[model samples]
Target: MIFDGKDLSHRALADRLPSDETHVFRECDLTEADLWGAPLAGARFESCVLDGADFRKADLDGAAFTGGGGMRIRFNDADLIDASFTDVDLSSAHFGGALLTDASFTGCRMIGAVLTGSRGTGFTLSRSNLTLANLGGCSLRGLTIEGVRFDDADLSGCDFTEATLSDCRLRGTRLLDTKFTQADLRGADLGEPDDAKLRAFAGAVITQAQAAAILAARGITVL
Candidate 1:
């Protein structure tokens, strides 16, 4: 049972679904719905309100959430490759080990979200607040993040190769073993990183003062 992108009510569409992905849901408001373990790949949810919806282990590859409002939604271990989320409220959301390659998140408010071990190859998160988020042991190459506040966030052993972080603030953020080879961090406020972290930020694009500070810690002053 699939509607051809036509307008349909939540009650009307739920009555026609086949308890699986065979029934396509287009542009419907599934707010607070129990959609756990649903195979809804290639489904287009335009401007849907999925606040507090449970999407644990859902196969949502190629899924599109445009102008969304899905706060506190669960996506644990969900396969979300090529998924695009615009204007989504993802506060306190958890995405552990989720395959998020090529995912685009624009104008999303992800305050205090937890995203550990999530693979983000070619991911884009513009204007998102990842403050206090746990992103340890994650790969984020070819990704672009802007206006992100990572205060007190755990970024240990996380890879940031060739990534762009504009206007990002890492105030007191944990960078114990983060890898940032060739990553651009211009205009970013990454206050006082440790020795191990300073080595990782050696080749990263940052202010000359930050580089000097890092080198100065090694007893090699640039006169």
Candidate 2:
């Protein structure tokens, strides 16, 4: 089923959807729409306004979300395996208890998004703004993360073993119990990491400039 340019705001659309067929929604205003437990597997949502839209417990595996999006959309406990989100504004979106394995998020504004307690092997995040987002206890092992910003975000207990971060920013990011064993952080801007934060990157590889900066911060002059 295809719904184009439809205003589905504040409507209960779970019962109206067909489970046997995949749906496509383009340029639709789905703000505050209730789709809890809806069977939306492999659905495509393009340029849709999803502000406050509730997709809790929805089956959204392999779903594709592109272009338009709004703040505070609820996706808690949703099944998002292999889902792709590109150029979407998903700021403050909830993903607690959601399964996000193999999900890819690119060029998205994910500020203050709560990804803690999300159950999955892992997900791919690139070229995205994740400032102030909470990704506690998440495992990003062996992933190549590029052009992402994690400024002021909480990364407590995250596992980045052998992960490569390029052109990334971790300014003021919380690294409590975070592991970076054998990770490559040569291209990341790890702004003034204190003793605890520096210890978090013990086994990680960094550039000479970063080392110089770290030493310079402690009043050490490097030749």
Candidate 3:
């Protein structure tokens, strides 16, 4: 309940929030703050800036966004269930149509974050950067994307069933109509995928130099 230089709305910051513990918003700036439909469950936003903050339909269940850097933060249609974004930067953050079940983004940066049509399940993006992030049509089923970068990311029509993408980078990623059923792309760096983007790596579990860089970009000279 420390709103320095206050410009309160959200029912006057939920009547000076202190409904039995856990509401420490240190270094509070809350730029463009609206906090629409605010409840802010278990809130603790350390080093808080919250640039362009809206938090539409906000609940923020189990919220804890340490190391404030909430650039372009919106969280459209937000609930953010089980939220815990550590080392947060959240560059260009939006999270369109957000729910984010079991959210836990450690070491987060999230460059160019948008997350269109978002709906997460068992989320846990460790060592996250999310470069060029869009996550188009996201469902993100069975998520655990470790060491994530996702360079040039759009992830068109993302589903990622049975997901466990370790050491992820995915350069030049668009993967139109992306599903990756039974996904487990070990040590992933899936670039050079021609032949119509290798059919989105069906039943994804690529290795062997990403199948010789997707059959040498469809030249098919793999020995």
Candidate 4:
């Protein structure tokens, strides 16, 4: 029971059994609240305004949701390990089976968010604006992303082995079976791809203008 920076306003705590395990509600607003089973670990909804709230099975560890506009919030089976979502909007929000380890989404909006089967580790989203984000089966192996801007993202079965996407923008992205095998797609832009975009940087271990802009966008315009 570590209630730091307390201010629990508009509290409609439902399914209550977690009698003050860790109810911070820091910088609180807790809009349309219904905090179910709130035994939330180290819970600190900082700069809060948890709109349409219903934190099911809450045990959010190291919680710190910086800034507000938390729309339609509902973190099902939440454990949110190392939780820290800065500049939040979290549109179409839903964190199913959440236990997001080392989670820290900076400058967050998370448009069209639906993080399926989430089990993150050092999941950093810098310069964030994941347009049409779905993030299926996220198991980012060796992940260390920089300047993130996943434009039109789906990233099917994502497991970027030895991952390090510097200056990323996989345009019209939906890279199924996504694994830049031995990753480091440096200065990535994929040359304005649109022709049924199927980006599978085969045995990818990049450089050299990112393999000459993915072989000059598959047109192989004789470099």
By lDDT, the best candidate is 2
lDDT of 2 by residue, 45-86 (tens): 999999999999999999999999999999999999999999
Compare candidates 1 and 4 on lDDT and give the better one. Answer: 1
Quantify how close model 1 is to the true structure by its C-alpha RMSD in Å.
4.4
Instruction: List TM-scores for all candidates, in order.
Output: 0.77, 0.99, 0.34, 0.34
- As for candidate 2, its clashing pairs are none
What is the TM-score (0 to 1) of candidate 4? Answer: 0.34
**Looking at candidate 1, what is the lDDT of residue 222?**
83
For candidate 4, the 10 contiguous residues with the lowest summed lDDT are 190-199
Which residues of candidate 4, in runs, are more than 4 Å off? 1-11, 20-33, 40-51, 54-58, 61-71, 74-79, 82-91, 94-99, 102-111, 114-120, 123-131, 134-161, 164-169, 173-213, 218-223
Each prediction's whole-model lDDT (CA)? 0.74, 0.96, 0.78, 0.70
Write the candidate numbers in order of decreasing TM-score: 2, 1, 4, 3
User: Rank by lDDT, descending?
Assistant: 2, 3, 1, 4
RMSD of each: 4.4, 0.7, 12.2, 12.3
Encode model 4's per-residue lDDT on 144-221: one tens digit a residue.
Answer: 776666777787878878787777687777877777787877666754644434356667676676566656777786
Clashes of 1: 1
* Per-residue lDDT of model 1, residues 18-47, tens digit only: 545544545556666766677677766766
Error of 3 at 131 (Å): 20
Q: Considering lDDT, which of the candidate structures 2 and 3 is the better prediction for this target? A: 2
